[model samples]
Target: MIVLVVTACPAGLRGDLTKWLLEVTPGVFVGTPSARIRDLLWDRTVALCNDGRALLVYSSNSEQGMEFRTHRHSWVPTDFDGITLMMRKHPPSEAKRRKGWSKARRQRAAYEAR
Candidate 1:
């Protein structure tokens, strides 16, 4: 099975808490206040939708921010419009050190360096 996990905290607590939550699973945590809500919704055991105000944490619809659970592996954009997927990419194995990333984390250092 597949899951879209998300972690969210207040603006002041986003940094450390976001990282901690991600450590719990292969999910993403959104730091921005606006996006945090959306991320949390996605990270739940259920699906979510981006309504531009709050994220529909659990839904039966297949619209924006919707996570489809199938046997297929696919890629979903982190951000569409004002909504961002609170998802992270796992770090490559030791053999992939040359890739210069421990895992697929959009850390502040990495995001700011870009």
Candidate 2:
């Protein structure tokens, strides 16, 4: 069995994928297709995804019994100690931490000053 998930993609991609798999939810599809069909679907999805992100998960004989692949996404799939893991890409430290007080914090400070 295979599952495909697409996010923030074009309507046409969704429509095309529906032809091969059942759309269980807005961006989720599930089906049992041959390896060739699954690969073809994934290739087509990559071509149509453009700036969007996609994830494909399928049953396999691996240790996890399932494997996943991702495209155009911030979170990356990695193999660690023979285990599959999802690693998130975080922004630079400067962008991660606010340089100054947030609006709510500033407002509270002003109220305290009053």
Candidate 3:
């Protein structure tokens, strides 16, 4: 089985993906298409996503029994000792990091200033 999740992508792309997969939700598709078709769909999604993000997950023979691919997203797919992993890439700038930091960080900084 294959499952695809798209976020902030064009409506047309979602419609196109629906042709080959069932859209269980607004931007989520699920199906069991052939590998070639799955790859093609992923390519098309990547091309149409532009600045949006997408994730494709499918059954696999790996240790996890599933594999996933990501495009134009902050979270990245990584390989660790034959295991597939997902990790968030660091923000590009300190300003962005500060914007996302938890309130605990601010509290710690305030305590340190005392």
Candidate 4:
């Protein structure tokens, strides 16, 4: 069995995926297919997805009985002591703003002052 989760992608990609897998919910697909088909599907998704992200999880003989693959996703799959895990990443400090207030805040301040 394989599961695919796609987000912020074109409708065409989702429509193509429906030919093989059942979309149980928006952006979530599941199906029972041979390993070859699963790999081919993943390959096609990788090739077609533009500026979108996908996460693939399939049954395997691993310790958790599942494996993961990601395409263009910020959270990466990692092996921690032989166990698969998803690692969350924080944005760079440079991307964080340390100063300045928005116009909304300025307006609120003036209102409070009045």
Local distance difference test values of all predictions, in order: 0.37, 0.94, 0.92, 0.94
Cα RMSD of predicted structure 2? 2.6
Off by over 4 Å in 1: 1-65, 72-94, 99-114
- Leading candidate by TM-score: 2
lDDT of 3 by residue, 1-114 (tens): 999999999999998998999999999999999999999999999999988999999998878999989998788989999888999998667764444568998899999999
Return the clash pairs for model 2, or none.
none
lDDT by residue (tens digit), candidate 1, 24-78? 3433332323345544433432322221112223233455534433111233336
Whichever of 1 and 3 has more lDDT, that candidate is: 3
How well does each candidate superpose onto the true structure, as a TM-score? 0.17, 0.82, 0.79, 0.81
Q: Which stretches of candidate 3 lie over 4 Å from their true place?
A: 95-114
Instruction: Give the range of the ten consecutive residues with the poorest summed lDDT in model 4.
Output: 90-99
Per-residue error for 52 in candidate 1, Å, reads 34
Candidate 4 structure quality by residue, lDDT tens digits, 1-114: 999999988899999999999999999999998999999999999988999999999999988999999998998988899999999877777667757999899999999998
What pairs collide in candidate 1?
5-43, 6-43, 28-86, 78-85, 91-103
**Stretches > 4 Å off in candidate 4:** 94-114
- The lDDT of model 4 is 0.94
Q: Which clashing pairs does model 3 show?
A: none
Clashes of each: 5, 0, 0, 0
Candidate 3, which ten residues in sequence have the lowest lDDT sum? Answer: 92-101
Model 1 lDDT-worst window of ten = 47-56
lDDT of 1: 0.37
Please, what are the lDDT tens digits per residue for candidate 2 over residues 1-114?
999999999999999999999999999999999999999999999999988999999999999998989998888888999999999887657565758789999999999999
Error of 4 at 90 (Å): 2.5
